[model samples]
Target: MSTHKPLGRFLTAGAVAVAMLATAACSGSTEPSSEVTELTVILANSTFTENLPALAETYKAETGITVNVEAYGNEQLNDTLKVKLNAQSDEFDIFGYQVQDVMREFVRNGWLTDISDYVNNSGDWDWNDFQESARDAVQLDGKVYGVPVATERHIMYYRADLLKEAGIAVPTTIDELEAAAKALHNPDKGFYGIAMRGARVPLVTQYSSFLYSYGGDFQDEAGNSTINSEAAVQAYNTYGRLLHNYGPPGATNMGWVEASAIFAQGNAAFYLDADSQAYTFLDPQKSAVVDQVAYARFPAGPAGSHPYNIVFQTLGINSFSQKKDAAFDFIKWVLNKDNAKLLLGEHTLPVARSSAWQDSSATEKFPAGLVEIVRDTDSNYVGHDRPQLEAVARAREFVGGPAVTAIEGGDEAAVKAAAEQANTEFQALLDTEKR
Candidate 1:
């Protein structure tokens, strides 16, 4: 969701082809033109989705069905799905969505066709290949609505050469993370300590790791608002201070893409972003510090490093589709081991398959310890990056305002006041949704 802004309209085929590799399957008059079935898929134009046309072409060649792929920006796709699916339009047979952000509304509106039977009845699909956390996220009222497409967690990406120059080891705790940033900071020399997401919306995902590590969250276990807790205040203060004091100029204007670019270009010593962003950093053509990049777990706080390990994207069949079976087939085809291997080869986000992560070919593709960090974090401490409430997108807007202000160097008093106001407003919105 943090790459380029999602265009509100369907993307062009050429645009999708940029990041995708398509292959034609063996076909010699297996089925006549009249017997072809066409299924449409709509998804966000991310690394995974952009490359999906390749799988679609393979599916088409296998079954003689024409698979049409349509992609929109993440937010735009969410809004488009909301509007189009609510009307029960059959324009798309299947779609992918941000699970935590949009599933609540999609489930409530009954726009998704439940695919539990497809999951439960298929053994070769190795339904168990998916991690439990990922499987659980796509379910609603104990029924599976979608198949998880992409899963990720926030991890630390640092300049190994810079750390060595500073005579420091990789940070393991919140205090060390701060020290590392402060020590490497040299504004006069045009280098920053850290490159962090600060734009209002995308900031929410980055802040979640800090918030959880400090033992604060959007709500308590009982679902009451905890945005104004003492831990909340401290977490906000620490995050704000790190960026305002040691971050690049105009830090508040940056999201993951901007911040990660700064890190990849060697302007910052450390960057906090999703693991998928590492692809750009590792690509020599896309980065200046490719060989200097290294990965680490999100630095631990007093509560330990509880990063958001979320199945961020999922594919589902539309309830209104006349081609639900074909849609499910397409979903299966895309996530199968061979296709996942292809995605891994492209250095995209690691998928939900444990076996995939353990594959030698997949492991050897990246920096030494990335797959290990991805594996450990995936199996250990991870949660939803955001709340799964009906009002989540709106909630992020209000709840995230204070962090944005703090990162912009607002005075302590003003930042605290903003948090207090956001707490009340956020609770009110959550309460409205509950009622």
Candidate 2:
């Protein structure tokens, strides 16, 4: 989690659209009707949930549908959903989930509805408006299971004051980024060259862009592990060396919350992670480098700056829900173009709508520099951040072993051996799934 703060309680109709979408799942109506008067929704602890109550309030006023929201932490939400869906509970009509982490697992478990036919049949909801990657993120076996809520990518956060004071231009390539980090590194004075997730499990997603930019991937088309490939080894080497050489000590236990705090407190020169955390740095109350910070696209590596452009959050209807049509109606309304613009404009949330990206007025809330960077990176990005598997958590632990070794300052040979070991174990895991 990014340690993100929620929006204001009374934001407006746009903020509550999420609640409407979830509520849509529980109502047992063939079409829009007065019979479906209330809806129950479950959500992970997020910015969306912060506004959920007020959002549901607005929805109720507009459509007379009362939307009840239950917010839980990510782990708890997963566990709760599993328990409830296992009993085929219809307590929640719809819910929000991390697409990459749980979509495949949910689909396989028959926990989500295949809304493809109805979604495609709609005249107003232009499904094509979503990014190709976002659209694909919600699908399994050619069946659409959910609607994407937002698009996310890895972005670089840098100390603008430090770079300028040191007479260094913003780095454009990975090599230059290292050179700049080296120039600015002053750990003896309590400042370091860079910061990033270093803990083995959480590091995988941030490490993904490095893997891709070096022409490596977690797996190949044949579903075999590629984590120990020549390119992969090099990528692991670069990530490990940077953290070991420049990051804070005891970084092995640090996740985004800790690592990002280092940079936010003005203790690091560069930080690389999900763009969703940008707000943590931008909020003056939570940061020391508010004005000193600047945004950049992930610096290009050997292959290029191929950050993961992913649909991090998505809304899905309960497969067991009797009010399937009502749920679809809610989704259609919640994800409509107008509501997308409202989210982008008010909350600075990066949405899945390409048309929304073109709305300059809506994008102005983001830094001028960021708008350009996101626009360029959005067009050139890989679809998944971590290994795309049903067992994502386990896969992250496996693929990240070499990076952990690298971060601990292992020699190239040791790192390579770790990659080899991890790859073998990961392959075994994959093979089991095939059987």
- Residue-level lDDT of model 2, residues 1-435, one tens digit each, is 222333233335654443344332232334344468767778887655665576566566777888788999999999999999999998788899988888888988889988887667665467888887778778877899898888788889999998989999999888998899999998899999999999999999999999998888999988899999998999999999999898888888999999999999999999999888887888988999999989999989899888888887788989887667766666677667766776677666688887777789878778787777666645568878888788888988899899999999999999999999999999988887788
Top-lDDT structure, candidate number: 2
The global Cα lDDT (0 to 1) of model 1 is 0.77
Candidate 1 local lDDT, 345-427, one digit each (tens): 45445788766777777667767668888667554455577755788878888778888778888877878898899999988
Candidate topping TM-score: 2
**In terms of TM-score, how similar is model 2 to the real structure?**
0.88
* Residue pairs with backbone overlap in model 2: 16-55, 24-327, 26-93
lDDT of all the models against the reference?
0.77, 0.82
The segments of candidate 2 whose C-alpha lies over 4 angstroms from its true place after superposition are 1-35, 61-64, 377-379
- The TM-score values for the models, in the order shown, are 0.83, 0.88
Model 1 stretches with alpha carbons more than 4 Å out: 1-38, 60-66, 73-76, 346-349, 408-416
